[model samples]
Target chain A: MSETLQYIGLGIMSVLNGPELFSIFGIGVPVAIVMLMGGLLTGIAVGATPGLAGPMAMAISLPLLISAFGFTPDALLPVFAFLIGIMKGATLGGAVPAILFNLPGTPDAMMTTLDGHPMAQNGQPKRALRIAQLSSVSGDTFSDIVLFVCAPFLAVIVERYLDLPEKTALLILSISFIAAVMGASVGKGLLSVSLGLIAAFIASGSDLSPRLTMGIPALREGFSLTAAVLGVLIVGEILSTLEELWRNKHALKVKDVENRGAIDGLQRGDIRRIVPYIGRGAVVGTMIGALPGVGSTLAATLSYTLARRRHRAITASEDPQFGTGVPEGIAATEAANSAVSGANLIPVLSLGIPGNAAAVFLILAADSIGGFNPGPAVFTFTENEINPQLVTAFGIFTLMALGNLLNWTVGGSFMRAMGVLAKIPAHYLLPVVLLVAMTAIYFQETSMFAIWTTLGFGVFGFFMRKMQVPVLPFVIAYILAGPIERSAREAFSASGADPWFLFKSPISVAFLVLSLAAPVFLSRGGKKPS
Target chain B: MRRINQNMALGAVIVALALFALFAWVPNDTVSGFVESKRGRLSIGDAMAPGIAFGLMALSGLILLLEARKGDMPGALEQRTFAFLLVALTACAVSFGVMIWAGPLAVAVFGGEGDTYRNLRDTAPWKHIGFVLGGTGLVTTLIALVEKRVTSNAVMIGLAAALALVGVFDLAFDNLLLPPNGDQ
Candidate 1:
């Protein structure tokens, strides 16, 4: 208890004395606040917009901030604050369209609409929105606290396994886990992952030259992550959307409704009704988040399905109805998704294996900056390089808590405000999305090649959608490929190219066994699909 | 189903081309030369013996296969449109390759048909030609002007400014760009 107090005191002092905090007063607190507000607003705008998630916005803004303001720690504070605000805001805001228009703002918000829209239809929009906000904020705060406590502990354990072979095995295990959890067809998932690995390999550096350039001078430096991601995710999604439009000329019409009002805060009855469901969802989401490849979406779906089943079983016994515009439905989804937000960071922070596309983007961004590394040694390596005054793992927790608190207090009002945005026409919205994507790609390297690559990837994305292939595995595979290949190469070199040596390390053997066993076990108890 | 099968075959061929580029054209010249040199050290009799054995085996197999099944070649018109598109695409690729030496505008003009530009309001041949030439010229000139005006130092400064912007957002807000790159 005393140690915890000391740590808390140190964290508080560090925040107070940090250069970032000092610079704010010099610039005037009002000006700093305004800048932070601007960042928050911008984050909300980007987050609520499809194809403009948190990472992309940061990528687009980071270079501009660096070039405009220099590398002062003070300048970064507001931006970071804004990103967190945006992440929290956008997630909640996503359900606005999902509830009112039947269109999800982001893919992750799909499950929210299931019961949320029904409540809205039943003239209880405010109630539904309130429950979602409360559950979401609660889950988010809970997870952030967990992250704050667990990161250092996990970091400590990770530091001891910083060798090449272990890293390689860990990466392999991560890939296997991801492939297993992503979709129903393991063969297709593995194929997609393998394709991503092959693509990354084609761009990796070799002693003679960067591989597979075909004497093209432009490609000599290899493909940039920004370019690859833009191509695969943004451009691809757009092309796929366009193809859908081509196939189905008519748009699906949804009923338009006005924002009713703020959520009358949850009643005691509501709390009692939702607590068990929220708890279950949070536990499931966190567990899913800890694993590689199994992201929040799967967690949300699994939790929702499980909640429905449990709700049914209980109601069947008691002669009660469940899942009909109930707060428990909202609780299940909000808790599940919000819990995933923190849990997903576990693998990335601990093992340097990003569990999802967004996590992959964050890891890539960290690598570009000077202070951090992704592997097991990050905690120790970063401890020395990072400014002691800026060491704010605790502060991060505080901010996350504050962010969620703000979300809970005013979440309903925020959702109502977001409804005003849903009126924008697709034509206008899509063009802005295209422009943002173009500017982001251009800023990454200021090369026309990246733009063309993005366009090409858009076409590829369209085809993949048509083929019913999941794109997530491909993204994870691409990010993991370089690290896995590099680590494997290093491990091979260390072992004098003896393949058996991969299993020689205890960590490697353990991870390999787990990787092999996961599929068999996960698939065993689940009912076979009809 | 037949059309889809043909498309898949075409995809296979395209894949083959890509693989050749990856494995053969992209390898280090020294590596290729070393492999060739080692192969050349082998005796002619050693190489010829294997070739003869493989050829005899193939001949025997082919004779037996001729007795088992036979098939006719595809009709020329069955995939005439697809064949034409493939040829056109191949020509476009060749033109892009040729433009590396001849320059972009020159190839765009000489390699293209007048019908390609026929949709333009400028009906006169010279006007159509002038549009292509003038547009290319203007772009090239503008690029040159920008290059001349912006010194290397200025470009470097611009890059530095961009980096600082990224640093500010990352450090202050904790919102990061992407993998292993941003604050976790």
Candidate 2:
């Protein structure tokens, strides 16, 4: 249609208007492009390492970016561009370690090791790496396009139809789904959510009444979201690492993995063989990503499992199996995991609820840099004024595409450079990271008490991880609690004091039912051992 | 089994939270026995946190109790893992131990105008944040090195790294506030 063409032309123009859109050091530099490249490079390095993942990188980088950019609308695009770059780059970078060293840098890469490592052992490391790159880039591109199409539609529908009570129910449903799928058990997940809600409750500001801060002056100001997240996710992780180091103090053997094996480009036939599996992975990954919290590991596992089953059904059972370095195995995993990078934003942009830890960090970064509020109103169209938020979202999509393009070109070298990245000893890294996290918090809050809060939360987060309670649900709950509270209050008031008002609407009723049932059924069906 | 201990720990935690919701904390600081949120007048939103917290805590506690009846809730978290966690925690705690006394002592000795918290601020005259941070780094490194029974060289490096961290934060980010002299 002409409308589609017109939109495409506009998109092209905006992308080309990069120099005008972005500036750094008062120079007309393409800031989004630079952020995308820098974030991608950082992501690739972090992901290729055995211990670090994309979210960890993003969490550490967030405070630095905030300090640099300050709290401004212009900061959002560059920050997100870098983050999206990391999300995309990490997916591909994870495959490097899994294939070359048989060490999965992240959980999703666990599956990649099955086919990829075997391929490395069988002297097809380059071929396997190439397949992973192509499949990953393909899957990410496919999912980004889906996100570009679907997030707006989903948000528009919610804006048009959903009211306050329905919105509350929808958030409940999201919480239920996230809690159901995240931790070891639904009970544990719910407990984490409750704790998060409690934290939010403690922090909630009141008009006439005193908040539930329990009388301490520091408590009155409440907990900072950045400090909490940095403490819990980044600093807690550092403590955990330190614990590991102390326990393994005598076991400091530097793993000297020979960075041999020249990576060869994928042939047309290799690409042809992988195309179908990549397509399947994209579809599987997209479905999982759009949901609240079943993350990329599940997507990769399911996609690879299905591909294996389908391949077995089609071909002779004895002929080249998935475990035997088949291209399809790599394709399925890489593509599926990669698809999650973009599609994970769906629930985030549409509902303003972060489904997973990575999404939580993204939302935290967005909160730090204001002017873009995620929710149904974000998708609202007005005839008079331009929807800058929606425009920013579109701009983010363009950056993600550029990230994929970067991965395609520089990703091979990234795999080779993994040795240097992974070699940075944890003892050195942890100390510096701890300092940085504390400093960022101190600068932002201008109070050393905030730093203490960060440390306390870090300890608490470590315990939460150790206890097997999922941290993601807790954080998401904490983040969404204020908004949900407002919605619930508004909905209650609007219902003329009807106690059972949430169940009055069919949509609300359906969502409420789904929220209740999801935990029971989904938790029962969970793969984690009891 | 260790998972059994974890279950009990979780149960204990839930019980503690539930009690807090029901009795200890509420929206209002004003009322007696059964009051929820305290208000100057009457407000509808006062009961939201307390009421929600109570209900949700009860439900979660009940569910956790039910799970405790069944056997192993896996994914590590045992007394053995708790030992290592304690070690890391102690190191971190030792590092921050100075922070607790630094502000109060600084005020006592140097005589700051504001409260204890203010004396600890980046701008506080009495506070020497750099030395405090360096001291923390020293304690952390000392703890780790003594535990490992490493040579003096390792101790020196740890001390160097601690001071380096203080220096790096100072130079790289000028406006960044540390314990006191920590920024310098």
Candidate 3:
């Protein structure tokens, strides 16, 4: 415990006393903290826009940041600080458009539009925004606390008990669980994962030689991770969205509703009314966030449903229902979704598995920045030397706490002001975004090969989406491919070439069994017909 | 009642491909098979992981095919989707082509026969030519495709966006180069 406290102190000092951005009164401000503020503001701005979100912003900023800082140990904290700030700030900022414009700034904020829009239309826009801000911060803080408590414990446990084969089995189990839960069917999800694995396999192999290159020289060094990921997640989405907008060109535009200016502060008893919902949402979001690949959308949906059921049972008939402008609804959704940001890092920091798109970017950052590799080994406590990864982890936590502080202080007003972003036309914005994304990738790689790879992946991603394949599973599987193969190879070699090594141990056998059983049970249990 | 589902049909295709990987591609493409023995010790070969992945793909494809009787997969692309993709790809290719060749062509045209584009690739007017023009063209063309017509406002916005990007990537970061410029 004392050691943990010591590491925490070192982490805080590292963040506070790092290379200075500038000095005021002979006191230098740390670069990481300043970047945190910058990222938070940028995140809020982007999240307020209809078509933009946190991950896109992170993806665009990553290459630029890497170029600025290079791949150095000192770069990790500032880079991660900015990314985590974006993750937190975007969660809070998403509620703005949901309330004011009846548009969800982020996908998880779709639930917010139900009650938030009504609250705004009823001349309580600021009240709704304030409630969202408070609830989001409450949930985010709650989950950050959970993350701070849980991640180290989980990582320690994983590191202690999981051997090579068990680790391999655990990875397979994670993939199976993700495949089972995402996409239309388990089959499609597995197919997506397989394709991703194959893609990752191309131009990559054991030290012997490259596999699946098909004689292309460029294939010798596999596709650029950033280009491929951003292509699918950002560029493909842009293409799809633009296509939909073009198809619906003749559709009627939504007329802007006049705002009824009224006193907009939360009235007495409002906090009391929403506290229970917030608590429930935070719990639900944290639990889901701990699981790899289960995202905040599910958390918000589940929490909103549970809150609605309880609200209906207790409230008077005229007090307002879940879908029609209720503070409780906003509280539930904002709390649940915002809570997901911090807890999502649990998987990334503990298992080195990304739970969602935001976490994926964090993993990419770690991979690109070098020096910091997140996994069970990250939490290793050593007596002789300081574990740098542990310090980085705690430094990340400090940055998250700072982000939450910023969210509490200035995030609300900034979010409210960002409602104007929702008015930007997608046609104009998307093309420019595409251009910028391509340019950014080019500047990073300084190779047209990366640009072409991005375009190729973007096309594949577009078709994959059209075919209803889940893109997240593909991406996660792609990232996990290298690690999974390494684990498998090590386990195989360690077991004296035991082909059934995954089944040799009880823990691994259980994990393998669960990997097979998850899709069958989950698909049967949860899959709904389209 | 059992019509072929598009996803299921795609699954069948994937199954065939996976089978090819297992039976043909993996054996031929990889130097060593699933397992290799070197110095009397055993190790997993490069083909092992892909072989496993392809096997999994085959299994999942079979499952998809089996489920085909239940329902059709949603969100299948229409003909117009392909059309849009074609136009988008064409625009990208054209813009890229222009980005690559425009500066060199302009240098050859404006400068005397002795002055080459390679000499002036990093200079002000020459360096900015391809990225700004190609980027603006790409953006403007995409907007036109979406709006079904070209508008001055769209062109202006596209030009402004391209310039801003050049400013951000080039002027701001002296180390960074725009597309084609980096290639050159």
Candidate 4:
């Protein structure tokens, strides 16, 4: 515990004494803090705009950040700080569009539009925004606190208990669970996972000769990770959105509302009324977020349902109900979704499994930046020497805390002013986004091959989405393939090439059994996690 | 009915691909077998992971096929999808062609007798030419295709975006180079 505290202190000091951005009165401001601020503002802008989200911004920024700060240990803190700030800021900013224009900027904000739009209609737009900001910050802070306490302990426990075979089994179980829970059916999900594994294995990283390059010279080098991922996630989304827009010729226009005796601020009574909803939202959001592949859309939905039930029971017949411009509805949804941003990191930090797209980007950033990697080893403490990864982990936690602090102080007003961003048509933005994404990929890989690969993957992704196949399982499987193979090989060698290595140990057997059973037990049809 | 047919077709395609991969592709493409013994130490080989993956795909494909017969419908692609893809890909190809060949063509036409695009690729005017032209064309073409009209506003926006990207990526960062230029 003392060692942990010492490491935390060291982590805080590292950020404090990080590469100076500027000096203020004989004191230096670290680049990490400034980047955090910049990322938060950008995240707000992106999230406020309909059809733009945190992951897309992070995807576009990752390569740029890498270019600015090379693959060095010193770059990790600032880059991570920026990404985390974006995650937190976007969580708050997603509520803006929902409240002002009745459009959910991000899918999780769908619940927000239920009450937020009505509140805007009732001339309590400012009140709704205030409620959203307060509850979001409160829930976000609660989840961060839980993460601060939980992630390190969980990592330590996982490190102590899991071995090579068990770890390999665990990765399989994670993939299976994700496949089962995501997409239309267990079969389709598994197919997506298989395709991802094939993509990852096409050019073998470990072997002297490439495995499945299929006689293509470029395949020997394998596809670039950033290109493939962004191709599917961002470029694919762009293509799909553009197709819809073109087919329907529908351009969305936001209608302005006249302020009718607008009440802006929340009272003491209002605060007291919403606190319970916020607490419930925080707890529910955290629990769901800790489970890989379950996202904040479910969290907000569940929390809003719970809040509605309780509110219905207590309120008089004449009182404003949950969805009829009530502050409580906004509070419940905003809190739950925002809480998810912090708690999503729990799985990533503890077990090296990403729970959502935002978490995936964070993991990608860590992987690209090269010095730090997330997993149980990240929390490992030694008696003799300092663990740099542990310090980086603490630095990430510090950034989260600072982000929550900024959200509490200024995020509300910034969000309220972002109503105009929601007015920008999505159709106009997507093509530009595609061009930028291609440019970003090209600049990083410095090859036209990467651009072509990205375009090819983009078309594939579009088809997959249209066919109702989930893309998340495939992406997660691709990321985990290398680690899974490494663990399997090590376990096989360690156990003298025992064919049934995964089933030999009780824990490994249990995990393998669970992997098989996951599809049967956990399959949820065709629901996209936001 | 259309959705069900789509699912069935998809399932069949998946099964065929998986079978080909397992039987023909894996064997032909991979130099190593599923397992190899090197110097009396047995180890898993390159084909093991892909073999298992393809096997999984096969199982999934069979399941999907059966499920489709049982009246499960996921979704179907519309004819508009192919049309959209055709147009989009055509635009991308033409724009990229201009991007790749524009600089060299310009150099051949207008440069000093012995000067080549390679020599001038990093220099001003030459470096910015391909990116600005290709990027603007791409963006403008996409917007025009979607909005169903070619507007000057779309062209200006695309041009501005291309120029701004150049300013930020090329001028601001000394290490970073724009596309095709980077390839050059």
Assess each model's interface with DockQ, reporting 2 decimals per model: 0.04, 0.31, 0.76, 0.78
Candidate 4 ranges with C-alpha deviation above 4 Å: A524-530
lDDT of 4 by residue, B1-184 (tens): 8888888888899999999999999988877789988999999988899999999899889878877887756668999899999999999988988889888888999889899989999998988888899999999999999888999978988899899899888989999988898777
Better of 1 and 2 by TM-score: 2
Interface RMSD against the true structure, candidate 4: 1.4
Where does candidate 2 chain A have its weakest 10-residue lDDT segment?
Answer: A250-259
lDDT of 3 by residue, B40-102 (tens): 999998888899999989988997887675666554767899999999999998998888899
When 1 and 3 are scored with DockQ, the better candidate is 3
lDDT of 3 at A342: 85
Candidate 1 local lDDT, residue A166: 72
Query: TM-scores of the models, in the given order?
Result: 0.70, 0.87, 0.97, 0.98
Off by over 4 Å in 2: A1-28, A249-268, A526-530, B27-43, B75-77, B97-175, B178-184
Comparison by DockQ, 2 against 3, better one:
3
Per-residue lDDT over A1-530 for candidate 2, one digit per residue giving the tens place of the 0 to 100 score: 44434444444444446545456687776777788888898888878876577888888777767766678887887788788778777888888878877777777888998898777776677788888888888998898889888887899899888998999999888888887888877888888888888777774645444467567777766788888877777777767666666667433223443435645456558877888999999999988888878889989999999999988888896788999878899999999998987888888888897876778877887788988887767766555566666666666667777787888898767765674555555555555557556656766766666777888888888877777777787788889888887887778767865678798999999999999998889867644521
How do the candidates rank by TM-score, highest first? Answer: 4, 3, 2, 1
Tens-digit lDDT track of model 3 for A395-490: 999998889999999998888888777777768888998888888888789988888889889988898788777889999999999999999999
Of candidates 4 and 2, the better by lDDT:
4
lDDT of 1 by residue, A1-530 (tens): 54445555655544344444334436533223333344545555554454345555554554444444444444433444444566666666666666666666666667878887777766667677778777776777667767666766686676665467777777777777775566433433444565566556553543354555556787667667666666676666644443333234234234575545534445569888888988888888878777777756777788889988888877755543344566777788878887877777666666777776556655655544434455455444332244332244444444556566566666557566665565553323332344345435554454445655665665554444444335667777778876775676556657765657568879889988987776556544332110
- Cα deviation of A291 in candidate 4 (Å)? 0.7
Question: Could you give me the TM-score of model 3 versus the true structure?
Answer: 0.97
